[model samples]
Target: MKRILIILQKEFIQIFRNKTILPIIFVLPIVQLLILANAATQEMKSIRLAIVDSDHSPESRSLINAFSHSKFYTHIPVEGGVNVSIEQIDFGKADAVILIPKGFGEYLIEGTPVNVQLMLNAINITSAALTHSYTSGIIQNFASSIGMETINVTSSKPSIRHWYNPELNYKLYMVPGILVVLVTIVGMFLTAINIVREKELGTIEQVNVTPIKPYQFIVGKLVPFWIIALIELSFGLIIAKIVFNLTIVGSIPLLFGFAALYLIVALGLGLILSTSASNQQQVMFMVFFFMIVFLMLSGLFTPTESMPQWAVLFNKINPLYYFMKVNRMLILKGSEFSNLWDSFVAISIIALLTIFVAIKRYHKSV
Candidate 1:
């Protein structure tokens, strides 16, 4: 008890006093939370759309008005006329082009099919998808409104519903996802390199030769990190609530429970890496490689369903994927344990595996 207490006090003092890391410990997560959360979003807004109103009639004006009124488009003027050449859309000068062919009003009055070309930039797949969805929605609504006003056709009214995020504000979806990233950084990167730093500085050897148990040493190192992580998480959540107006639909206690589980798994992963690494650089690189894979696989930026079947299967086993899912569920969907059994089960399994690996490696070292 005395040895563990002494080691804990030493670790705490080192952490609080370290000139290089103390500032990072206090500021890095907050900065990342503010910047990345704001930047990372599923919805693409303010798309630069080129207008080619060749018709120059009331009908074309109305169609253009529809886009302008919506939150999606920022209409850009064409040089020659409203109908910009194909070159304009192709060269990435425009995200989308609304081309109203000549005599569009004649076709509208005659009830004839008018070809309105919507050229979209497909290079940015996400922006393209949003553009397509927005354009399609606008056209669908226009057709329906026209049909309802002009001709009474006995057709069923389409009911549109959005899953997960109904309003699709973007920030609501990103806040929780960013929290997952902060957790990974604090638990894996910080702890992994810290352990290796002690090893490199010859401090670990001095401690290792003492009467302290390996578990005691590991726990003493881990506890301070865990406390610091909790503090960071609190600050993150508070910021999320204030700046982003993020919603926590699930129980706060439940979120903390899952966070605790995730922290255990993360610490174990860090310990495994720390035990195996010969130096801090190696630990950092190894953990970074793993983190990249984990972040990409997590369904934060894109739908997990959109990934290739093999990648989807691989993501099922990814710990960060589960963490991301849990956070989204808690924040957006108000998901309970009953609503998230699959994610809970997967996270639990991963936590066990990491702990087992870490313990095995630690014992081997001792």
Candidate 2:
């Protein structure tokens, strides 16, 4: 324990003495949180709308007026007709085009059914989906205001209650996710790079020649970083609360407690990668591969349920997947400790497996 403390002291000095490392560890994460927390959103506003009406009647004008009045749309100018509007969409000037068919006002006047065509740019699926939903909703409200009779007499309107996120703010979801990613960046990349830098500088041989055991050396290397990451997380939580109005409904201690275990696995993985590589560049390429794969499979931006069965099975071993899931549940839903027992158990197993392998792989002679 004494030897480990000495090593820990040396590591902290090395980290803080370097001016570049300090900012990378602390500043970058906050910047990313501020930027990405706001940027990665499911909400769509100020849709670029184009209307091409063939009838040009009062009903058609009323439909166009409805779109113009709504907060979701901004109508852009079109020189020609529907073809011109379609060209605007193709040229990236419009997001949606509403084509009011001929005789639309006549059908409405004669009490007959009429249909309007809606065309949307589906390149961004979420934006497209929201635009369609909002546009359809406005159209339906207009139709109802005009006293259009519904065909279904028995259909009942269902009330929807969005629990935990009533305003559906996207930042609430992204802040926690970004926090997890920041911890991962600091823990994994720093551990791997620090050790590998020592190896490249030929300083590792000096340490290996000393009386330090592999387990002791590994613990000494990881413990300081574990504490530093926790401090970073606390700082991030405070920033999130101030900037995005984030709330932690679940136990803060539980979240950090699980994070400590999760960092064990992350740091161990970094150590194993560092031991395998001859230089920092090789370690970087390897880290990049693993990190990209982990981020994509972690259900951060996408829903894991929508994935195929094979991909879902593959994510069972992914540490980020479990961490992301648990963090969101704790922060958003205020899930209890009992509800997250499986995640805690899974991270424990992962920590044990990875740390065991890292220790066994680490040699005394470097």
Candidate 3:
């Protein structure tokens, strides 16, 4: 215990002494949190729409007016009709084109079915899909107002309510995931890099020759980073609350408790990487490779449910996936520990596996 504390003290001294690591530890995560929470969003706004109205009738004019009044669309005029609108789409000037064919007003007057063609630039699939949905909603609402029955509806209109996030603010969704990323980076990357750096400088040899056991050494290496990562999480949550106006619906102590266990999984993984790698470069590359895979599979931007069956199955082993789910559930939904027992058990198992591997992999050699 005393030896472990001494090593822990030594690790802290070394971390604080490094000039570059201080910025990475304290500054970079904060900057990324502030920038990414705002920048990384799925919300679509200001869609450029081109309307080709061949009819020149009041009904066509009203349809165009409906799109123009929407906050999501900006109407671009095409003088040469559908051909010009297609050209605009090809030139990247328009996201979607609404072709209001001739006799559109006549068909509506005759109470006949009228078809309005919608052409979308599918270069960006997500944008095109969102544009299609937005424009379709506007057209349906316009048709309803003009007493045009596009579809014979026997069912009542559904009362839609968005729970957890009533406003659907993207930041509220992104901040918790980003916070997990930052904490993971600190716990995993820093631990691996610091240990590999010691290996490069021949410091590990000196430590190995000492009276420290392998488990003690691994525990010593793990504790400092574990504490630092928790501190990082605390600071990140504070920033989330103050800057993003994020509200924590769950218990802060419960969040911290989960974070403490999650950090063990991350830090132990780092320890394993550090034990296997001989240099900082090797460990850094490994960290990057793992980080990319973990982030993609973690459902940070997209839900894991939307992924393929194979991906969903493989995500069971991903520690990030469990923590990401747990973080959002706790912070956004106010989920209790009882509600997250499976995640807790999964993370605990991963923590034990990683620590055991890290201890076994670290060789105490002169």
Q: lDDT: which is higher, 2 or 3? A: 3
Q: Give the distance in Å from residue 69's predicted Cα in candidate 2 to where it truly belongs.
A: 7.2
Model 3, position 188, has a per-residue lDDT of: 95
- Candidate 2 off by > 4 Å: 49-71, 75-119, 135-163
Local accuracy of candidate 1 as per-residue lDDT tens digits, 284-308: 9899988988899888787888899
Candidate with the greatest lDDT versus the true structure: 3
- Model 3 accuracy (lDDT, Cα): 0.86
Clashing pairs in 2: none
Tens-place lDDT per residue, model 2, 128-210, is: 86677677667776777788742111121222335787545778988888988888888888889888998999898999998
What's the distance in Å from true for residue 6, model 3?
A: 3.0
On TM-score, who's better, 1 or 3?
1
Off by over 4 Å in 3: 34-42, 52-66, 78-87, 99-117, 138-173, 249-251, 301-303, 306-309, 332-339
Question: How many clashes in each structure?
Answer: 3, 0, 0
Q: Give the best candidate by TM-score.
A: 1
Candidate 3 collision pairs: none
Candidate 3, residues 70-174, lDDT tens digits: the string is 888888989986788999989999998888889888888898877788888998898776666666667777878988775221121332345898545678999
TM-score of predicted model 3? 0.79
RMSD of each: 4.3, 4.7, 4.4
lDDT of 1 at 231: 77
TM-score of each: 0.81, 0.79, 0.79
Instruction: Sort by lDDT, best first.
Output: 3, 2, 1
